[model samples]
Target chain A: MSAEAPPAEETIASPRPVRGSLPRRLVGRPELGAVVGAVAVFVFFSVVADAFLQWSSFSTVLYASSTIGIMAVPVALLMIGGEFDLSTGVLVTSSALISSMFSYQMTANVWVGVGVSLLATLAIGFFNGYLLVRTNLPSFIITLGTFLILQGCNLGFTKLISDTVSTKSISDMEGFPSARKVFASHLTIGDVEVQITVLWWFALIALATWILLRTRAGNWIFAVGGAKEAARAVGVPVERTKIGLYLGVALAAWISGQHLLFNYDVVQSGEGVGNELLYIIAAVIGGCLLTGGYGSAVGAAVGAFIFGMTNKGIVYAQWGADWFKFFLGAMLLLATLLNWWVRKRAEESK
Target chain B: MSTSRTSKASQTSPASRKALVALSDISKYYGNVKALDGVSLEVHAGEITCVLGDNGAGKSTLIKIVAGLHQHDGGTFAIEGEETRLGSPREALDRGIATVYQDLAVVPLMPVWRNFFLGSEIHKGRGPLRRLDVEEMRTTTHRELLRMGIDLRDVDQPIGTLSGGQRQCVAIARAVHFGAKVLILDEPTAALGVKQSGVVLKYVAAARDAGLGVVLITHNPHHAYLVGDRFVLLKRGAMAGSHAKDGIALEELTRQMAGGSELEQLSHELARTPAPDLSGGVAKG
Candidate 1:
C-alpha cells in the first residue's frame, strides 16, 4: 500500500529523513501527553468558568503575560540556539529604573531615557556573549554571575538614591503627560480591553517567529544549537550566532522593562526577580530542549498563553488564588515528562 | 573498482589545470608537539585525491587546515594555484569550499529541507517582509536529493530521523546544491556498517561525477582504492610517499599500509639464525 510508482521519479531517489506522519499522529513523539493535558485544561476552563469566557478577563491575562510572553519568545530561541541568559530578570528592573530615573530625576525626555535603557541592556548582553564565546564557558554559568552582580547593583543603587528600596513616581515628570499614551495606553475591542503592550507583545512574537523559522539567521540558530562544531565545520559562525542569541535575550528584557514601567508607573527595587527562570520555564513548556536545538517560537508563545489562561482561569473558576503556584508547578512537570518522551521516541524511530 | 578509466580533460580546459586545493609545507604545533610537519599535497579538479594515514599520522590536522578549522603554523596554503588565506570556515565557504566532517555536521532536529538550505536560505521578500521561501526550499531539497538518488516522500522530516549513511548523503547533497567547487570529506564512512558504507561510497562517486574536486580522507586503503585517482600516504606527521592509480597495485598499497617491509625483515632474521652450539659441546659428551 505504501509502494511508490516506478515511473513517478526518474531515478530511485535518495531517501531524506522525513518527520510527519498523518495516520499514526503520534509519529513516535513523546510530547503527546502534555499536548493533551494543555487542551484538556483549556477546554475545562472555557466550558465551566463564568468569567473565563469573558473577553476582559482574557485580556487581563494577556496583559499580565505580555511581559513574560515577550521575554519567553527570545529565551525559547536562545534555548533552541543552545544557550540561556540568567541576567535577564534583574536587567529588566535595572533598565526600567534607569529609564524612570533619567526621565524624572534628571529631567530628560522619555524617549531618550528609553533609548539609554535599551543601549545599556544591549551592552550587558553583548558582554555576556563576548565572555561566553571567548572563554568557551557555558552561557548558563556566565549569565548566572551576571545575574548575581546585577541583582546586587539593583538593590544597592536603589537604596542609595531614595534611602529606601523603591524609586519615586516617574508619573510626575513633565514629559509623562505625552509619554503615558505610547506605553500605558489601553485598547478596547467590543467588550474587551487590553493594555497597549499586548500589541507590542503580538508584534514582537510575530517578528520573533519570522526570525526563527523564515530567515537565514534562523537556520544558523538551529545549526549552532544542534552541534556547534559541526556547524563551524560547515561554515556557520558559531560564536556570532551565540552572541546574537544573547543580544536578542537582552533586547527582550529591555522591552519587558518598558512594559513594566508603563504598566505600573513606578519602579520597585525587587521587581522582576525570579522571572528569568520563569521565562525559561515557559520556553521549556513550549517544547524547547534545555540542551538546545529543535523548538518553535510559536510553541513558546502558545506556552505563554497557557500560563495566562490558567492564571486568570483559576480566579474565574473561584478557586483559591493561593493554588496558582502549585498549578504552574504541576503544568511544568507534565510538560517536562512529555518533552522527554517525545525526544526518546524521536531517537528510536530514527 | 577496475571498471572505471579517467576521462582525460582536453588541453582546452585551462592552462595547467589549477590545483583546487594546495598545502605546501604545512605544519601544525600543539604545545611543542609537531602534529603536522612540512606536509604538502595538491588536489585537482575532476579527480579524487585520497589521503591515507593511520591514527596520529597528522591526517586529522591536515584536513582541519583545509577545512579552515585550524591554521598552519608553518606553510603556504593555496587554492586555484593562487596563494590565499582561509582564517575561518565562513571564508572557506565564501570561496566555494565546503567540508563534511564526520558526525554532527548535519543538524539532527532540523527538517531535511531546512538542513539543506541551512546558513544560506532562499528568501521571498525584498525588505521588512522578507521570509524564507519554505515551499521553494522543500521542493528544491527534494529535487536535489533526488538527483543524487535520494528522494524522500516528504521533505519535512527531521534529518535526525534518517540513518547515518543517509544523513551523510544529505550533507553531501547540501554541499553540491550550494555550489561547492571543492568538497573535503573527513572519514565519511568510518562508523558505518557494510550496507551503510556502500551507500556512502556511492554518494562519493556521485559527488565526483557532479564536477566537484573531491578530497577523501580515510585510514582505509581499501576504501580509498575504490575511486581514488591519486593516493598520498602520511605517517608520523610527514608524507611517506604518494602514488598515482597506475603506479600502485592493491597488494602493494596494503603491504605499505600494513608495514610489510619491516615484517619481512624480522622474518628473514628469524629464519637465518638459530641455536649456535653450546648444544654442540654437549653432543661431544
Candidate 2:
C-alpha cells in the first residue's frame, strides 16, 4: 500500500516561499570547500611548476590520485556513517599477501587466490563491525585492534611462508595475464596513456555518489550518523547500516590490493603501513566530518586529486620530499577552516 | 483504586466498542524500584487522552510501555481488542502505533523532507537500480506540512534551522501521513514557549480531527485541558485520578496534577518560613 496521501489539487497556492538563489544553494553542498581548494591548488601548481601543465605529467598525477581515490571514496562513506577503519592500510597488504602466497603454494590459477583473498579480507571487515556492535566499544578501538593484528600477520605470515619480507613473483602463473589486464592494464586515451585504476576510480566515485544520495540505505546512513538513537527508534536498522559501511571499505581494499600485486608481480609486506592515514586525511579534506553524517564521495575524490597534485607538484618544482608532509598538513587545516566558515554561512542564511 | 471509579464505569459502558489501545493495571519495575504501578488508560479513535503528572510522577515510564520501548511487567496491554506485548518500536509501527519522542524525534542535520521519510523511505525501480523517490517525497513533505498549517521557506533547509515547535509539527505530520492509527507524543511541548506550545497543541488537535487516537504526555494542565477529551493523572507510579471531560473541571484537574494535598503542605510550610534576607546573605558571602 502507498504510505502517503494522493496529490492535492495543483490550484492550491504554494504555502512555501521561494527557495534560495543558486549561489546560496551552492554554498550548502558538502563538497564546496574541497572544489574551491582543488581549483586553488591547480592554479598554484601551474604557476610554480612549469612541467605541471603537460598532458603526460597530468596523467601521472591522475594515476597517483586514482590509487588513493579508490580507497578514500569508501573511507568517506564510512566517516559519513560516523565510524573509522584504521585497519584499512595494513589490510590492503594483508589481502595482497594472501593472494600471492595462496597462488604460489597451491600452484593454482591466480584467479583462485584472488577469490580467496576477497573472502578473507571481507571477513576481517565483518569482524571489526561485529565486534563494535556486540561489545558496544568505540569504532576507533575496535578497528585499531584489527589494525595491529593485520600488521603483525602481514609481516609474520609473509616471513613464515616465503622466508622473506615479500611474496614471490606470480607473473608467470596461470590466469596472471588476464588478471593483470583487469587490474593493472594501461589505456591510450588520445596521446596520453592512462592506468586502469583511473577508470576504476571514476567508476567507484559514480557508484558511491549514487548510493550516498539516491538509495534507501543512503538515507539510513545519514540518519545513523546524524542521530543514531533517533534513527534506531524509528526502525532504521542502525547496526546493519554500520556493518554494511565497513564492508564497503573492505571491498575497496581488495581491489587496491589486487592492483598492487598485479602491477609489481610481487607483494611487499610493509608497503601500506601508513596509507590509512592518507585515506582518512583525503576524506576529511573533502569535507567528511570526524563526527559523521556530513560529507560526500565527490568531495573525497576532489580531496584525493588535491593530494595527487601536491605530491607530484613538489617534485616538478624540485622541492625536497620532506616538505610534502608540511604542505599537506597546511592544506588540510585551511580546507577544514573554509568548510566550517561556509557551513556557518549556509546555516545563518537559512 | 479509589480514584478509578469513573474509569471503571466508563470501561464497562464502552464494552460494545473496543479502543485502539487499552492498558489496564499496567505496571513496570526496574530491579527493586516500582517505576510505574497499576495504571489504566484507554485511547479511542478521534480522541485525545492526556496523561498529566509532575517530575518523577512516572509519566515517561507509562509512555515507554505503550510506545514499545519496554514491556509492562504486570497487567495487560491490548491493541484493537487483542491482548499482546510489543517487542520493539518497529513492531509498534507495524501495528499502526507511532511514538514521537521529545528530544530524539528528528536528526537535526538532515533536510526536512529527508527527516519526514527517514525510516520509511519511498523507492522506485528494480534491484540495483532502486533509488529514493526524491521529487515525490519532497512534494509530499511540503504538502503535508502545509496541510498542518506550517508554511516553510524551503524543505531543503536543514531541520535544525526550524523552530522547536515546527520540528514537533513536522514529526506529527509525518506520523499522521504514515497512517498511524495511534500517536503517542512524549512531552511534545515541554521545551517550548507559550506561543510555540499553542502551535503544537493545535497540531495535536489536527491529528485527532483526522480520525487518529492520541496519547499526549505532559505536565501542563492548562495545555492539557485545552485539547484533552479524557484526563489520566499520575502520582508516584499510581493513578491519582482519572476523568472524562464532562466529569471534571479544569481547576480541579490542575489542583490534582499539582500534587493535590502535597502542594497544600508545601505552600503552608513556605508561608510559615520567613523570606531570606538576600542583602545580609550577599554581604556575608
Candidate 3:
C-alpha cells in the first residue's frame, strides 16, 4: 500500500522507519569485542600499575602507537581496496637506513635525507602497485618480493655505507635542526609530554577518515575494493585507485620510519622487520576484512589504540614482554571469529 | 525511419506517456564480436522494460551500455526527452541514470545507508568544506526504503545481512534516492525464488509510480509478464523484436525464449531413441 507521502515543504528531520542506524549498530556490534578487550586491558592495568593511569603513560602508548597507527590507517584502506602490502615493514626499515646514511654517514642535510627517504618509500609503493596491476598477480607475492628486496637492501646498504649494520648518531650530524622538529619533536601537556608522533597519528587519522568518508575519491576507494569488477563496470578507475592505495601505504611506512629513526638515535638496518604483520593485525582488529569490500579507517585507528594499550598494559601488569606475541595472536583470532559471528547475525536477522 | 519505428514500437509513446529513458539504436562491440546491433527500447515512467535473451545473446552487453558501465559504439540515449550520451556511470548519474547490478551494487559489509550512498554521498556546506550529512542520509535512507515498502529495523546493519530480495530492494531504493530518472536493473531476479522475485517486481512498479523509468533485464519471461510495459528480446547479439505489454503473450515469449519447437523435437527424438539395445530384448515403447 502506498502511504501518504510527505509534502515538498517537509523538514529534513522527518521521522524515519529505519530501526537502527549504522553508527548505532557499530557501537553495539558484537564484533567490536576487541575494542572492549582494549578497554578492559587499559582499566585493568591502570588500577594495578603505579603510573599507568597518568598522562606519562598515555604519551608512551600513544607515541608508540603513532608509527603503527599511522601505518594502520592506509593499510586498512588498502585491505579495503582488496589488496595487501607485506613489504610495508621492510620498506620502513629501508627508509630509516636510507635517511640515516645521508644524515650520519654521507653528512647530507637532514631535510634532504628525510625527503629522499619519503620519496624512495613512495617510489617503492608505486613500483609495487604498478607491478601488481600490470602482472595481475596476487599482491601477497608481489609485495613479498618487495619485502625481501627492501630487507636485503636495508642490510646490504647500511653495511656498505658504514661497514656496520647500525648508525651511532645522526645527532652530531650537521643540519638536523629543522628536520628533527617536524617529526621527532615533543609536545608537552603538563607533566605528561612525549614524542610529536602523537600529533602525526591524529593528523593522519583525520586525513584518512575525511578521504574515506567525505570525498568522491573516497567512494571510489570503497567501490574498487568491494568489487573491482563492479567498480570497473561503473567506470571507476580501478587500476589508478589500486596503485594510489599502495602508494598511500608506502607513504605511511615512510612516516613510520621517521618516528622510529627519530625516537632512537641509533638506527639498525633490520629494525622494522615483521612490522607488516603488526599493521595488518591492527587493521584486521579494527574491522578491515582481508578479502576486501569493507573496512573502517577510524575503526583501524582504534584498533591501533587497542594494540598500544595491550602492549604497555602487559608490561605494567608486571608480565614479560615476550608474551606480547601470544596476546596479539589470541586477540586476532578472537576478534576475527567474533566479527564473523556478528556478520552472520546481521545477515540472519534480516 | 528506424528511430520512428523503434519509438512507435515501444509500449509508451514519448508523446503519449512519460518515458524515463529512451535508448534508440544502441550498438556495441567487443573485438570482432558485434555484441549489440541497433538495440532500441524505452522504459516508461514507473514501468518495467524487460530485456530478455538467451546465453550469448548480448543481454549483458546491452545492460552495460544502458547502465553507463560501457560506452556504446553508436546510440542516442535520452532521459526525460533530453538526448544525452552516457559516457560513464557518473555522466549517466548526472542525467539521473542509475543501475542496480546483479551481484548487488551494495557493499556487503557496509551499513545500509553507506551502501545506499556509495558513490553519491549527501553532503552539506560548501565544496571542500562539505562533510557527510550523516543524519540526513541515515534518515532519508530509512524514509525512502520505507516508502519503497521496505521495513527495516536498522539502517546500520551490513547489507550482507539482508536477503537477496532485500538487497535488491535496497539497491532500488538507493537508485530512487539519488534522484534517478531511469533505473536499470541487471538481472535483479536471476538468483531469487518465486516469492523473492515477487518482492522485487513489486518494487519495480513502485519505482515507476514514483516517476522513475526502470529497465528490467532478465531471461525470465514470466517475471517480465508480471511487471513489464515493454519487452525487448535479444538472440545472438541482435534485437529479436520489441513488443508492448498489450501486444505480447507470456507463453509466446517463453516459447520463443526456450525455442519451444526445438525442445519438443529434442524430447521426441529422445523418446524415439532405443532405450537399451543390449540383453537381446528390444524395449517396447
Candidate 4:
C-alpha cells in the first residue's frame, strides 16, 4: 500500500521564503486568546483582592476549576466534533443518583454501584449520539430533549426510590473509603492542600490534548467538524466519530458525578441543573469555536481556570455573589471577541 | 448513436488490452426523472478520458457512479475487467479509485499535512501508546507535493490559504501517493481563474503521465482537447457523441459541445436583434 517513492534529491526554488517566526506561529494558535485572557484575569484579581495570591486561596480556586475542567474537556472535544451535549449537567446528577440509590437499595458495594452507574451513563450518551446521527437533527434539539428527560428522571427516580428529593448516604457502605480516596480525597502538596479532582482535571486535559493533536481520531474530529462532507468523501467515519465524542462527554460526566457523590456523601437530584452552561462557557472561553472544527484542550483548561478565578476572586474582594454571574458573562464576551479578532488577524497574515 | 460510437472506440483501442475502467450503457434514475441514460465510457492506463458537458448534463451523475457515491440503475461498470458495484467511497478508494471532488476535496481549516493524511493517517507504536507518525507524514506530504511541482512555503498553513489550483494539485498528489490506479476529477477548474485553470490542468496531465487512468470531467473543450485521448460528449442525460483523439478535430468537438445547431440558431437570433428603446422611454417618463 506504500505508493510513495523514496525521496529524491532534486529541489525546486520556492517563490516565498518560509515565514514561520515565533510571533506569527503563536498568532495562529487557537488558545492564544485564552492564554492572554487568563493572564489578564490573574493580574486583575491579584491587584484587586488581598487574599487572591495566597496559597490557600489559590488551591481553592484550583479545586473549583477542576470540577468544571473535568467536564469542559469532553465538552470541548464534542464541540470540536461539531456537536453538543446539553444533557451533561443533569446527566451528572442522574449518575450520582443512580449510584447512591443502587448501592442503598441493593445493599451492594459502592464499587458495584459506581460500575453500574458508568454503564447507565454511557447508555444515555449512546442514546443521544445514536438518535442524532440516525435522524440528522441539530444536536441542540436532540440534546435539549435528553436534558429535560434526564432532569425529570433524576428527580422522579430519586423520589420514588428514596421517598425524598435526594439519595441516602453511602458513606458507610463497603468500598466507600477507597472510592472516596479515588474521587474526593485531598492531599497536602508541601504546605497547600489540593483536591484530587485537580489531578483528574489535569490528566483529562493531557489525554484530550494528546487525542486532539496526535491520533487518527484527532484528525477525523477536525475533519468532521470542519468539513463533514469532505471528510466523508475521503473515507472518514463521520457518524462513528460524532458518537465517540458524545461518549467522551458521558465518561467525563460519570467522573464528575462520582466526585459529587463521594465528596458530599449524598446526591441532590436537582444539584446540577444549570452547570452544563458553565462547562460550555469554560470551553468557549478557552477558544473552542461555537461553530466547531478549531480549538484546543489547553484552551478549555485555561477557560475553566478563568472561571475559578472569577468565582473565588469575587468572594475575596467582598463583592456580592450575585455579581459573579455578571462578571462571568462579561469575561465570556470579552474572551470570545478576542479570539475572533486573533483568528481574523491570523487568517489575514496568512 | 451510442452503438456506432462504441464500435468506433473498440476499433481505435488496442484489442490486446482491456480497459482499466469501462462503462457500458450506464443509466441512473431518480424516481421518474432520468439523470443519466445509455452513457458508455472507457479509461485506459496512462491516458486521460475527458467527459465534457454543460451544467445539468449528467457529468456529475457519471462521476458519482464511478466514485461509488451512487449505483447505476442499469448497464455494466467494470473495473480491471471485473463487473462490480461499489458500496461506498471507501470501497472505491480500496480498489485504487480516488475521486477528487470540485469543492469538497479538502477541509479548508485544517493544515495541509493534516488534510493530506486525514482519513488514512499512519500510526506507529502499539496499543494505547500508538500515535500518528506526524514527522513522517509531514515530510511525506512535503515531498509528494514537491514531486507534483507544488512548492509550498509551509505545510502547516491552513489549506484555505492555498489557491484553488494548489489545493486541487495537492489533492491529486495525495491520490497518487496513495496508489490510486484511476483518478477521477470532478470539474477541477470550474472555480479557478484562467491561469489557475492552466495550473490545475497541468497537474491533471501530470497524473496521467504517472501511469494512472484519469477520468477528467469538465465543461471546457479547449482544456480537454489539450490532454484528452478520448472525448465523451453528454447532452441532457444521454450521450450526444463520442470520439477517439485522432477521429475528431478540436473545432468539431467545440461545435458539438456548444449545442451544435442550437448554438447556430441562437447566434442568428442575436445578430439582427435591435429592440425599441423601451428603457429609455421609461426613464424619460
Candidate 5:
C-alpha cells in the first residue's frame, strides 16, 4: 500500500545543476586509465615490433584477446559486484570435459552433450553462489573450494569415463560440424582470418557495458559492492545481486568452454587450470577495483586487448616467451598504481 | 493518552494532525537484562518528537524497533493507529518509515547522484537493454538538494568530500524525496561540530515544516531543545520523563538527560571542600 500520510509540501533543496564540461566528464570515467594505458602500450609495441602493426598480426592479437575477454567481461562485473570466482578457471575446462566425455560415453549427438554440460556448469555456479550467501563466507574462499573440488572431479571423472585425461575426438560425432561452425569457425576480413570467438567476445563486452552503465541491476551491483550495509539500508536486494553475478560468470564460462571444445575437436581435462588469474589481471588492468564497487566492462575489454598485445608482441619481436609472466606481473602492478592515481584525480578534481 | 494517540489513517487536516507512529508501554529484554522497560513515545505530523537519552539508555534499541531493525519483546506499535509487525527494513520503508543512521547512511565513494538514489535507482527502457537515466537523475538530484537548502559544488563529486552535516542532510533529503512519512534520525547531530549541528537542525526543522512525523534521537538536550516539540527522556532502559515543549524547560530537560537524581548523587560525591584563606594569603604576599 502507498503511504497514507501527508506528502511533502514542496521540494527540500533547490540547488541548480552544474553542467559537466567535456574534460570533467573524461576525467570522471573509471576506464580513463585503461584507455591511456592501452594507447601507450599500442604505440610502444608498434615502435618496437615491425609486425605488430600488420593486419594479420593485429587479427591474431584480437583472437587471443577474445578468448580471455569472453571470461574477463563477466569476471569484471563480478568483481564490481564485490566477489570473485576462483573456480572459473577449472570451471571452463570442466564445461568442455563434460560435453566431450558425455558425448563420447553415450555416443550421442554433440549438441545433446553440450546441453547437458550447460546445465551442469550452471549448477556449479549456482552452488558457489548459494554456499556463499548462506554461509556468509568470502567469495574468494568459497570459490576456491569449488575450484579445487571441480579440478579433482574433472580429472577423476574424465579418467574414469574416457580411460585418459583427455576426451576422445568429437570430429565425427553428429552435430559436430554445425557446433564447430557456430563456435570455432573462422571469418575472413580483408586478408586476415578472425576466429568466431572474437565476435562472441565483442558481443559479451557490449552486453556487459550496457548492464553496468544502464540497468537498475547495474545500479544494484555498484550499491552492493560499494558498501553493502548502506545499500541494504536503502532496500537494495544485496544477496540476490551477488548471486546473480556468480551466475553471469558461469554463463561466460559455458561460452568459452564451447569454443575450446569445438576449436580442438578434443578436450583436455587439465586445461584452463590457471586462467582465472589472467581474467582477474585483465579486469584490474582494465580499471576494476580489486576491493570492488568501481569498474567498467569496456575497461575490461581493453585489458584483454593489452594481454593479447603483450602475448603476441613478444613473439613477433623474437623475444623469448619465458619472460612473458615477468612482463605480465610488472604490467599488473603498474596498471594498479595508475588506476589508483586516476581514481584519486577523479575524486579530487571536483 | 486516548486523545494523544488518534488513528492516523483517517487524518485529514493540519489542525487535528494524528500521531503517525505510537509505541505504547514498549518493553524489550535481552535474555534476562531489560534493554527497554515500559517505554512509550508518540510521533505526530509537522512535529519533531525528540527521544533524549545518554549512552546505554536504549536510544538505539528504541530506534531499531521503530525502524524495523528489531522486534520488540512486549509492546504495541501502531502506525496510523493500526498495530503491525515489521520484518525487515524494507518493510518499514514501504510503510514510509525511513531511518537515517549517524554514519552509515551513504556510500562515500559513490557520486552524489548515485548515493542519492542508492537503493531506489530510476531507470528507463525494457528488459536487459534498460539503462540508468543519468541526465534525469542528475537534474533531479540537483533540484532535490537545492530544495533541501543544500548547495553542492557538483552532483558528480564523491559524497565523501561533503562534511558530516552535508552527508546527513543529503540522507535526509533522500528520505524526503522518497516520500518518507515518518523520519527517524539516529543521533544526526551527535558527531557534528557546533556549526555542522546547526546546519542539520535547520533541515530537521525544514523536514518538520514539510509535515513529516520526525522521531529524533539524541543525547544533547540543548540540540534537542531547538527543534523538538515533544521530549521523551530515557534512563537505564526506562522512561525518566516525557514532556511537551510547553510543559518542559531547557534546564529541566538537561537535568533529565543527565539522569536527574543520578547526576545529583555524583555531584555530591565529587563536591570540593572550601579553601577559605588561600586566596587572601596569596593577595597579602
Candidate 6:
C-alpha cells in the first residue's frame, strides 16, 4: 500500500490539473435532471405496464415524441438564446392548412403547396423576430401577438378557402404519395414500425446539440440569451442571432407541418391551439429555465421523451387518459426543482 | 501581448508617438439638451488618458461619441490622425476603437472561455459546417489570462462567479486580445472593492505597457493619478481642464472634479459638524 501510494500521488501531481473533476462535469450538464427523469419514467412504465417495454410500444412512444421533439429542439435553442415563440403551435397547423388548401384549390401538386407553406411559415417567424427586435417589446408580448394573429388567420383562411374549419384532403392529389413516403413513411425494425418523424427527431437532436456545443453560433446563442446588451457590445450581432433563432423555429414547423399534412391528409384549423404549451412544457421539463440563458437540446429531447412516456404510460398502466396533464404538470415541476438543485450543486462544487 | 506591440508599431512610427484617437471640439445635442459641448482630448499610444467627471458631467456622452454609439454633432474625430466619422459601434470596432463599458459586455452565466470568445469566436472547417475551434479558444484564453497575471481555477466556471474586479480585468484583457488600438473603459472600478480596484488598475497598467492606448474614465482622482499619463476633466458637459501627469497635482484635480468651491463649501460644513460633535459630546462625557 505504501509503495502504491507514491505512484498515485505522482499521477495526481505530475501533470497539470484536469479541466474539471468528473463529478463537476456531470453536475454542470443542464440535462442531467432530464436524463434522470426520463430514465425513471421509462423504468416506472416498464414495470407497471408489461406491454410498455415491447418494441411496438416503444415505437408508438417515439412517434408521439417525434412530432413535439421536432419543435422542442429549436424551441430549446431559442429559449437558451433568451426568447420564446408562442406562435409555433398555430404556425404548424397554419403550415399544414396552407399546403392542403393551396394544393386542392389550385389543382397543383402537393409539393407546390408544401413549398409555398414553407415560405409563409418562415415569413411569420421573421415577422415575430423583426417586431420583437424593432419595438424592443418583451418576447412574451410579441410572440403572444403572433400566436393570436396566426390562430385567427389559420381559422379565417381555412374557412374562407374551403368553407369549413378544415382544409380539403390532398391525399389523392399529385405528389401526395411521394410526399407521404418522405414525411410519413415508417421504418421497420424487427417487427415494429416507427415513423420517419422519429428519425427526423433524432437527426434534429444531433444537429441542435452539435450547434449548441461545437459551433460559434452556439456561443452567440448562449450569450444572447444570458445578456443581450453584453452580447451586442462584444459584437455578437444580437439582432441577426435572434432572427436566425426564430427562423430555426420556422423551419422545424415546416417539417412538422409536412408530416401532419401527409399523415392525416387534411388539417383542422384549430388542431394546434394548445400544442405550443406542450412544446414549452417539454423544453422546461428537459431543463430549460423560464428565464432563459441556461438549457441544452438533449435535455429538451429527454423532456419530450418523458412527455411521450407519460402520455402513453397512463394508458398502458390502465389508468384514465385524463391523468396525462396531471402527470405532465407534476413532472415539469419535479424536473425544474431537480435542475435548480443540480445547478446549485455544480456551483457549490467549484 | 508581444504581437499587439508589433502591430501597433507597424501602423504608427514610434519616434513621433502619435495619438491613436483624437477628438477636437466634439459636441452633441438632443433637442433642447446639450449632452456634450466643446470637448477635446487625445489618446496616445502606450498610455492611459483618464477622463474624470462627476455625475451628469457627460462622461457617458463622451464615451458614446468615441464608442460610436452616438455621432458627434460638431467638430472632428480622427483615427491615427486621419479625420473620420463613425456611424456605429461596428464601424468603430473596424477602426480599432473598442469600448468596455461598466457593464463589461460579458455574459455572466457563460463559462469564462465561452465569454472570452463570445462575439469573435474562432472557427475551423468550411462553409455551413464550420465549427468553433473550442480547444484553441480554451488554450488561448488560458494563455491570455496568464499574460494578464490571472490564474483561474477553472475556465469552465461561469464568469458570473468571478469577483467584480476579476470580471473587469477579463473585459480589459478581452479588448486587448481583440486588437483594440484605443480602449475606452467606462468606470470599470466604480463598483469594486479596494483590492479589486487594485487588481483592475494593475491590468490597466499592464494594458498600457502592452502598447495600447487606454481611456480610463472615472470619478476618482486617486485612481486616475495612479496610472493616468494625461487627465481630461469634464464639468457641465464641457471640458473644465486637460493636464499632463506632470502638470497637475492630485489635490488640484480632486478640487476641480468636485466643482471647485462646491467641494470647499461641503468640506467647510463637514468641518463645522465635526467641531460641534467633538466639543459637545466629549465635554458632556
Q: List each model's interface RMSD.
A: 5.6, 7.8, 6.7, 7.7, 7.7, 9.4
lDDT of each: 0.80, 0.90, 0.78, 0.91, 0.87, 0.87
Q: Which residue window of length 10 is worst by lDDT in model 5 chain B?
A: B1-10
Residues A47-92 of candidate 5: C-alpha lDDT, one tens digit per residue: 9999999999999999999999999999999999889889999999
TM-score of each: 0.88, 0.95, 0.82, 0.95, 0.92, 0.92
- Winner on DockQ between 4 and 5 is 4
Interface RMSD of 4: 7.7
| lDDT tens digits by residue: candidate 1, B1-285 | 222314444422646677888889888999989999988888877678899888889998898788777888998999887888778788888888888988866888888888888777788988888889988888789888887777677677778888898899999999988899888988998998877877787778777767788999988888888878889889889988789989999888877776668868988988786566657878998
Badly placed stretches (over 4 Å) of model 2 are A1-12, A15-19, B1-16, B276-285
Better of 1 and 4 by DockQ: 4
Local accuracy of candidate 6 as per-residue lDDT tens digits, B167-239: 8888888888999899899998899988778788878877887778999999999999998989999998999
Per-residue lDDT over A1-350 for candidate 4, one digit per residue giving the tens place of the 0 to 100 score: 01222122354555333547889899999889889999998999899999999999999999999999999999999998889889999999998888888888999999999999999999999999999999999999999999999999998888888889989988989999999999999999997999999999999999999999999999999999899999999999999999999999999999999999999999889889899999999999989988889888999999999999999999999999999999899999999999999999988987
Model 5: docking quality category: acceptable
Model 1: share of real contacts kept? 0.53
Cα shift from native, residue A132, model 1 (Å): 1.9
* Candidate 4 C-alpha lDDT tens digits along B135-203: 888878887887777778688899998989889999999999999999999999989998888788878
Position B228, candidate 5: lDDT: 89
lDDT tens readout by residue for model 1, A140-251: 8999999999999888988888678887787766667666787778978888897877887788788888887788889999888887877766667788988998899888
Q: What is the TM-score of chain A alone in each candidate?
A: 0.89, 0.95, 0.90, 0.96, 0.94, 0.94
TM-score of 4: 0.95
The superposed Cα distance between candidate 2 and the true structure at residue A121, in angstroms, equals: 0.7
Query: What TM-score does chain B of candidate 4 reach?
Result: 0.92
DockQ, candidate 4, vs. native dimer: 0.42
Candidate 6: stretches off by over 4 Å? A1-18, B1-15, B270-285
**Candidate 3 TM-score for chain A:** 0.90
